[model samples]
Target: MQFDRDRFRFGIEAEYLLADKATFRPLWHNDVTFAELHNLMEAIPFDDLPSMDGLELEPPHRKLMPYVVEGYHVPNPDFSPIDILPKGVEIRTPVCSSIGECLECLKTLHDRLEAALSGSGYTLVSLSHHPTEHHFEGPQNKRRYDFWQWAMEVMTTCGPDINVSLPRELNDPIDVADLHRKVNYYSPALAALSLASPIYRGKLWKIRGTVGKSIRTYRRSVIAPAIELHPEENGRMEFKLFEATNRLEDYHAFFLLWLTLLLDEGLKGRSRDQSRIYDLGAVARFGLEAETVRERAGEVFAQAPVVLNRHGFDAGPLNIMKKRLETGRLPADDIIDYFDETGSLEDVLKTRTGLIHGTELAQDSSVNAAALSRSRQSMTGI
Candidate 1:
């Protein structure tokens, strides 16, 4: 079945860690911050959010709540309320007909969350893993908590689940299988672009005391799929490999990248599960520094423009990704460098907490692309 890009919908479920405004440390499950935020959100009127004309608002948004108290603390039938512990909150967008709309919706919800946290002595920070907490003590009877247990009790890591709705035409088994194969092939390399988790267990992660990049992905990749269909949502493919980022432009770029891959019929690259697992490990450790990861990512980025253009979309958002490839530096590298220079995790969290909210709608692709081109030309003496 052929996909008509015009009808495609996009959304995001972004998770953030809660931090103490003063100490910049991870907030515990018992903190009053959770209840305060929840109460404030409940008090907000639906009219506070900007209205999107001609768009169908769904679920949480339709119910006037776009943000929720998420993470390990959220109680379910399997886990009693007493056993539940809060870690952070998740902000999600209603299904949107375009990438721009989706981002706008996300920004709206995030802004609301920031407003609610104002003067509450708490703030949200985007980090793939907890910077200080090495372990969390919790009940361990359920098999579902295996990864959480392995990662040390609470899954302190927070990341975005990039969702794209598949049209009914592409819901058949043949198309679904093909989509899975392509996603597996490209996810490892694409994931390397968003490696923002360099520090883990209170220090820079070291493999046998060597430097490490993303402990979250390095460990989670073995157990999770690069892409999976949302069990409850019909035809929605969730790209699960990316780490969290504070920059709105990063999400802009990532969504477009995945959408391009989903729409591209000419790019038939496929990989077995074992090969993807192997590749993901290298990426999780060194990011683009690994030659295999860089080359594989380069191929996808090179082809992204053609696919995006064919779908009547701009490829300008990809400038940030191209710059990352050119410099061989992902977010984790910058974070590690900052921590090295400051010698304080609190200092790092201070800056990141401030960036938890964003108002920018999209990347200035034209400006970015022009600047990048000039830099490349000068470097090559062209």
Candidate 2:
């Protein structure tokens, strides 16, 4: 069962808060919106995605995709979980053979979805939590959306779920029981880098009324099974640590970081301390700079390239990630700064979160060039 080479494919599934662009309020996904989603998936064409695939719609009119994802999970344009207030929908990409293709296809998916919602007076915002409003609504699915929404509400006031997945069995780097252990152990740093929820339910959640600086960390953030985990022949690891982000490059950078680790001799080379889990609340509130024990997981992420290049794998992607690591800046830092200056969570989203422009997404020379360029463009206006 240990036969391996680096030939594997990857994909991404990201969800967004469906909100009114002008008001930044979550919108309900009813029958009409469902119909619109179906038509839009059909009418919208992807100029960049190689698939340019024709969509196949599932029953109940809640899902759309050109194909199934390796006979697993709902393909992108998924609209399941038909009940909940402050509705959210997910767009997932079928697995791709390379990081470049995965990211480009994901960007194309975002563009197609954005264009479809253009006339609907609603825009999909990719923040982890609804900035200014409280949500308690969903479709008519009594058991799935309604019951769970109510259940979750009673626990921590109210919350939204948005996250991305990385395949544990993809190709290399980490695998088997150790892969699971490393993933579980690194949840803190991963969550830190993925932080996007600075405001929660109309309040600055990074600080408490009396406890000084605090994070509104959701209860489900501890890599709990309830949030979800699926281990297929070709499986994926779902991390609930990150808030949703629309920028394809952010996904690109993250996966690049993953790639570096994969080629590193150090990942599968050592036995890590299983008890080294850091505080999720701390990482969520302070991304990148969040303190994690270097021996536990930080060294693996930071030194992936240095050790990896010595092993002969491409170090390009690793270097790219290291550059960002050098900056020590994260999306949450900018988000909180904007929130503090504007005094409006809605304004912070409008200014910081981006809706990827199609052509601008194609500036390809090298994966490194496109990624570096996109990273710069992603942060410019902010």
lDDT to native, each model: 0.70, 0.48
Please tell me which predicted candidate would have the highest lDDT against the true structure: 1
lDDT of 2 at 85: 29
RMSD of 1: 7.6
Model 1 CA deviation exceeding 4 Å by range? 1-6, 30-37, 48-64, 73-83, 140-154, 170-174, 231-234, 354-382
Best by TM-score: 1
Tens digits of per-residue lDDT, candidate 1, 47-70, equal 433343323333222234666665
Error of 1 at 261 (Å): 1.9
Residue-by-residue lDDT tens digits, candidate 2, 155-217: 222222222233344433444566555555664554455556667666677444421122434
Per-prediction TM-score, please?
A: 0.82, 0.67
Q: List the residue pairs that clash in candidate 1.
A: 73-85
**Model 2 pairs whose backbones collide:** 76-92, 83-145, 84-137, 84-138, 85-137, 85-138
Worst 10 residues of 1 by lDDT: 373-382
When superposed on Cα atoms, how far off is each prediction in RMSD?
A: 7.6, 7.6
